[model samples]
Target: MSSYAAVLRTPHACRAFAVGLLGRLSYGVVPLALVLAVKEGSGSYAVAGSVMALFGVSGVLLSPVRAGLVDRYGPRRALVPMAGGYAALLVVIAGVCLRGGASGVELCVLAGAAGTCTPPLGPTMRALWSELLPDRRMLETAYSLDGVCEELLFVGGPLLVGALVQYAHPATAIALGAALVLAGTVGMTGSPAVRGMGGGEQAERDGARGAWGAPWRPALVAAGVGVGLGGVDLLVIAFADGQGRPSVVPWLLAALSVGSTVGGLVNGAVRWGGSARGRLAPLAAGLAGALALAGFVPDPYLMAVALALAGLFVAPALTTAYLYADELATPGTRTRAGAWVNTAVNAGSSGSSAAVGLVLGQLPLALCFVLAGVPALGSALAVRASRGARAGVPRPESVTRVDPREPRSTAGR
Candidate 1:
């Protein structure tokens, strides 16, 4: 608690953390909101899934490009327009769906457009964190807290989306999420804390764009994590449907988030001496195993428990993956480096959605769970080839200097 407090003591830190959370809330809520809206409009989960699938693919293609812009031009110059543009897209999407004006082709195009426009706030916000706080322990704590905050968002986001979709409309939830993104980005980029920060140096920016200069390992591992997430999330929803209690879906997801939140808190608070890379694979394997086992559990309540167990290492694994990205990437590409992980996640989302959708239509749910875990395990293995586990967290570059003056202690920036 003290460490957490210490991290948030400065106005800079507090604002960065808050803004990150606000921006990411959209990420947490968007999938369900979009899915339900599309489903209600088209009367087919397949169409909904297809729209989201296309969105994921577009996101994957756009993450690196947008992140590169952030690295080169700075987050404020790069993201503010992005945030607003994405919000506008969401509104358009909602309107189209509500009016039933879009054909399959149009929906696919809109989904792609939305994905391409979607702000990569998660990575950019973390880059801001790296800028605001350069201390090692505090950085760890900040990262963990970020992860924990995301867990908390996931816990609430689904329920919020579900209720809105049921009561008002899916468009309402998505529009609200869009508002959060716009507000968060404007607030974050406009803040003094973020204003002081620069993008990467020219050389680092140049290298980020160069072929063979990418952070391939972290991207690969992140992709695996995405695959795991896509599979596990859909399976859980399936499990609830299978049990004839779709309303319990949020509760089950909340359990998983609780476990992940606990793990993230512990990982940050307890500073044991080990490379961040060392924990990546085993933790991922554990999460994968837990995911697979959960599918076999007959009861929905038991399945929730199983998911909780599986999610225990999730935040830790993800925290380490980012740390590894930091370690592996070139000096100037903070946002771009981490953005690859986001790309991988989007890729996994697209791939897994397609695969899981197929499994849901053709095969048993149990098989879907088993297949989902395999990609993560494979991605973990890929991490090994990239000096993973054996590598330590990256040291800050000597050239990247912090501001001379310190921030005032305050909850509000």
Candidate 2:
């Protein structure tokens, strides 16, 4: 708790964090809202799902490129136009949905455009945190807080949209989503702290190899985690629906969220003994084991307990990945580096949904759960093997010394 308090006490930290979360909330709200809106307009669940798939694919594939723009030009210049275009497209989507009789093709085009232009707020805010808190330990705490809050936002955003749709049209939720992102982006980018970052400051620090080199390890781990998580999501739905206890699904998911939130906060507060890089394999293993165990649970209530165990590893793993990415990043490449990990997780999750669905019908559910755990288990072995292969090579220092102009601390790393 003191660590979180220290993080909030940093100058301009609260404002930047607050506004970044605000903008990111749009991500949670828009997906559900847009799905409902498209379904209402097209009168076809198939059309809604296809449009969302296109939107998600476009957003996930192009994330690194957008992050690069922010790195080259700075957040202010890159994010402003991106947010404006995204919000405008969302509004257009809302209008088309509300007008009635809109074609599926038009909605797909608008949704794809909006996704392409979605500002990389999550990455940028994380980069800003690195700049604001040079102390590696403090930075870990900050990332934990960020990850936990993001989890909550996704959970809460749907409830908010659900309430809004009960009274207002589904299109209105999309419009509100547009407004949230626009407002959040404007306020966040205007901060002095964010304005001080990027602008090609250290763009060439790593030469032609680019910022993609060292952080690939963490990105791979993140993707594995994503794969496991995606499988869990689809499997949970199947589990609940198969048992004819649909009402239990939300409780199961909520339990996962609660475990993640507690685990993240604890991970940050404690001063762990080893380097974060060294801890990655064990964390992956923990998640893998928990997931494998989840399949054997006889009922939804017991499965929720197993899921809570798995969720305990979720935030800690991601927070470590982000922290490692930040460590490997140079001044100009921070956002891009983080974005790679960000993209990998999303890509893996998105792809896993389709892959898992095919296996679900043919295989026993227990075996399916074991298969879902394979990715994280593979990640654990990969990280360990890589560490063994590079035993003689010196690892990067855990502590980062910030410029005197920014916040600096000589506390424990």
Candidate 3:
């Protein structure tokens, strides 16, 4: 009968909360910033979309390498430099855009740089959660809370940035975003939870070679979910444009975000006694069907409703994926496992954005929605296949385990 509030009072929990806020806030501005920059600098929707797509591409490409760095050097060692570099890159991007004469290629390159150097916030925060929460149920609740925050960012970030860009200036929004990221990242890094990570020199040496054992199957399956959802976002925007209601695109996307937020909240509140894999198939199936229906809906309002329904499964599916990942990751490499999951998500989304953008140009928006569902269906199938193959595998609680060499708390023991 341990109280959640008691756990929350711990330094680790406090750090996790701070890191979560910073990470979500940083991500929230991304889509809005991309749209504003492209519209102002390139003056074309297509170009703007492409620039937005590059943000994902950059994250996808760099995440694994960054994860490896974290595994080798620890979160504090990796995050400190990365956050500083990210802030600098954001400033550079702002400067370039402000100059008003940069070419599309130049902007794209800068965009790529920003994306590549983007702080590994998601991965780092998830790592902090694993280190902080040792109990299974508590860890699950923590991740659910994280998911809810993500939903809030999606709901609020775009609207905030969009308004700023439309009313004030894009630079103003970008500047504010950069400042937030700087402050949040720095503060999180200084916390006891982050500083306490990766203490054993032997484990650190072993982890440097990427020795963290991780289940590739579930990670890959989760990547499909990311790709599918990322494509859905693009489709929403494209659908809005096709219907000549571009102004409504953010709201439409927010519908999905709101649904996800609700779903995460519910998941955190409810206790389910079953396999994570047991929940996977049904949720994936529901998500795929919802996404498919979204494509077929003719009315924008109906489409929004469909998207909201589709989003209901997002956090559950992702949470299951993280659980699967935890089951497979080895000691001293839990953070890398989290990073891999994030990388897969970002990579899938990045690839989908580029592919879906092309498809949207040629096909109808409805068709794009249908196409986007393919990845979700594929993920469902993959999870189903894995469940069949690995029947009755005991799930691990979380990624991190205490080292015997280090002083152990009575609670941890």
Q: Which candidate tops lDDT?
A: 2
Instruction: lDDT for model 1, please.
Output: 0.75
C-alpha TM-scores of all predictions: 0.83, 0.93, 0.82
Candidate 2 Cα outliers beyond 4 Å, as residue runs: 204-214, 387-413
2 or 3, greater by lDDT = 2
Using TM-score as the measure, what is the rank order of every candidate, best first? 2, 1, 3
List runs of model 1 lying over 4 Å from the truth: 38-49, 98-104, 165-169, 200-213, 237-251, 292-302, 357-370, 385-393, 396-401, 404-413
Determine which window of 10 residues in candidate 3 has minimal summed lDDT: 404-413
| Per-residue lDDT of candidate 3, residues 1-413 (tens digit) | 13335446655566657655875597788668867876786677777777777876777667766765675676677776877777777777777767765577877777777778777777667666666666566666767777677767766787788787777658667777777777777777777666556536634654755564445666776777787887877788777877889998877877887788778767766676776666766777788789889988887899889988987888977877776665455546666677777777777876887798787779876677777777778877776776334332243444354542355442322
Tens digits of lDDT, candidate 1, 208-314:
46623357766677778778787776788888888899998878877887888888999889875665566777777787788788878999889889878877877
Model 1: how far residue 219 lies from native, Å: 2.5
Candidate 3 — which pairs collide?
A: none
lDDT, candidate 2, 1-413, per-residue tens? 89999889887789888988999999999999999999998888988998898899888888888988888788888999999999999999999889887798988888889889989999998988887776768888899999999999999899999999999989999999899999999999887677557775355453344745337777888988888888887799888988899898889988888889988999989887676678887888888899899989989889999999999999999998887777666666778878888998898787778899999979988888888878888987897788433221222335443542454331332
Q: List per-candidate RMSD values in Å.
A: 4.9, 3.2, 4.3
Query: Model 1 reaches what TM-score against the true structure?
Result: 0.83
- Give the CA lDDT, 0 to 100, for residue 263 in model 3: 81
Name the candidate that leads on TM-score: 2
Cα deviation in Å at residue 221, candidate 1? 2.4
